[model samples]
Target: MTSVWDLPDFDDHEVVHFVHDRISGLSAIIALHSTALGPGAGGTRFWHYAHREHAVTDALRLSRGMSYKNAMAGLPMGGGKAVILADENGTKTPEMLAAFGDAIEGLGGRYVTAEDVGITDADMVAVSQRTRYVSGLPVSDASSAGGDPGPFTSHGVYLGVKAAVAEGLKTDSVRDVRIAIQGVGSVGSGLARLLTADGAKLVLADVNNDRAAALAEELGAEHVASDAIMGVDADVFSPNALGAILDEKTIPGLKPKIIAGGANNQLAKAEHAQLLHRQGIVYAPDYVINAGGIISVALEYLAQRDGEPCSREQVMERVGRIPERLKAIWQESAERDMPAANVADAMAQKRIGRA
Candidate 1:
């Protein structure tokens, strides 16, 4: 579960902590790849790990991925990831997120925080109480922002997916193409709307039944069990729920020609990309395809700190590049008989290389 990187050339990342009531559960890491560009920015993920090393591994992997994501998305910030070790099933208290906010404050302006998995706008507000080192909070007359980026994230992913579909459906159009979406959260729901508007049919499922059914009803799509989504005869498989879904065993069961979703780190291992390629499935690397939310935040940050007002159009214009990026990656992988993940990794790394 550890990344095998000879990062001897790179400086070791900084680790920080915030404890409350003698509870050290609110731990976080702030990795600065290059602040010569701007502040290190990324999201805070609250996860329940079996061991401390697992959490470390998650933080390292996510931080590195954020670096690549920012570079590819043309953002001015370096990468970082904050992880709070606690059970998501209500075991962690608001104090834990607030304490984590204190840790972000400790970073001063070195890092700016935002929402990620297992954290919400409310959680960001709690953190804002402790530090101005966070974004994605409530809006006011004094401030230009505060709201959920779910819809925007979904919009970018939807655009990326549409690009994938058009390329995927050269033999056919996406009209009535059955797409299986594996999460009905903000991202997935927004994707469903885009698909429906484009006359695409969706087979939707979520661990959250209420939201899933609501989305399905809105789009006139079918609802299936979350586990059943993999084999649902879908033309495009969207995994908006979780990551590492394209492993060895599940690849054989997937009934999709193209795979594109907002989940980070879709491959269980780098080799899984090879397996998917061998299976003839066109897979979009998560980092390349899911850069929408972070890109949006990056634009806002750059605008505020450096007088770079990234308009909504300019922000979305970056999203438009995702399709072209995917097409190039798929073409290169096919021409070279390489893994798409490697292609994406190389593409993303080139951006970091420039930095």
Candidate 2:
């Protein structure tokens, strides 16, 4: 078993717990980065990592990112993240979800879990049965405030893309613009629909060929091989699948002038932000652009606390601020000649009193 002390230069997390249940073949990590704003709240990612240490690393990094994300989105929540180590192709039963929920319940509300990556709203529903500290369950229940946050997240990404278009291409509309989307999952599909409605030309790619093909046919988009999507000569490259796609190797192959997507931590390393900046590519900070989900979910959490439920209008009003936030970050980047990632980090630090 790898211990926290064995990790090098790990962030100072408020709490870190390792959970295991041999009976259910469950192995997990929970990391809480902060609680200065409020209880730690973030999503739970279920992925079969190559090693235990890798899962631990992901939890720490994702939790820390959540702290910055929450602060940037003006939410009264800190950062926490959970990861369940399991084979991506393996079965994910309600029993496994309940066990994970039990682990979260042990935290006594210090950490809350939502849906991410392999986790789904149904999984969250299973988790909620074991612990009240879970969100993203089915929103049909009058007593529970949970739902798929993809549309809101994609909405913010859509607005952020337009802001990037204005700054990078000096255009007022995405109509006639070429956008290459690297994923066709929930968030990516939502973004594609919005851009398609606005008359943007789309090139889509995904590992799930059937889904991608159907979406492309529906939207009149051109489909490309998953590996070749990065090299497509589009005005924008939107990576919604996974993180670390903007590293050195792929950066050289990128043909887009704008990098904006719903993926968290799009840059492989913090320094990649500067590399993109030096390359004259407008890289909207991923955390800033992908905040709509958290904003919507956080409002739900807040409403739950106040014994009330937030309306769709109220939630969207807050999510709509993402573009304004991105514009502010862009202005700061221009004035300081700094990368938007750095500007966003500095802004988050200032909000969290680290500046």
Q: What tens digits encode model 1's per-residue C-alpha lDDT throughout 1-355?
A: 3342433213354443323345745555455544434577788887777786666666666776777777767777777777777754646677776677677777778888788888888888888898877766655532342356566678778877877787677743567888999998878888888888888888999998888888888779999988888889978999998776888899988889899999887877777888888888888788788887887677666666666545666667776777777788889998999988888788766666642
Best by TM-score: 2
Q: Worst ten-residue run, lDDT, model 2?
A: 137-146
What's the C-alpha lDDT at position 197 in model 2? 96
- TM-score for all models, in order of appearance: 0.87, 0.95
Error of 2 at 69 (Å): 0.8
Task: List clashing residue pairs in candidate 1.
Answer: 137-146, 303-308
What is the TM-score of candidate 1? 0.87
Error of 2 at 84 (Å): 0.8
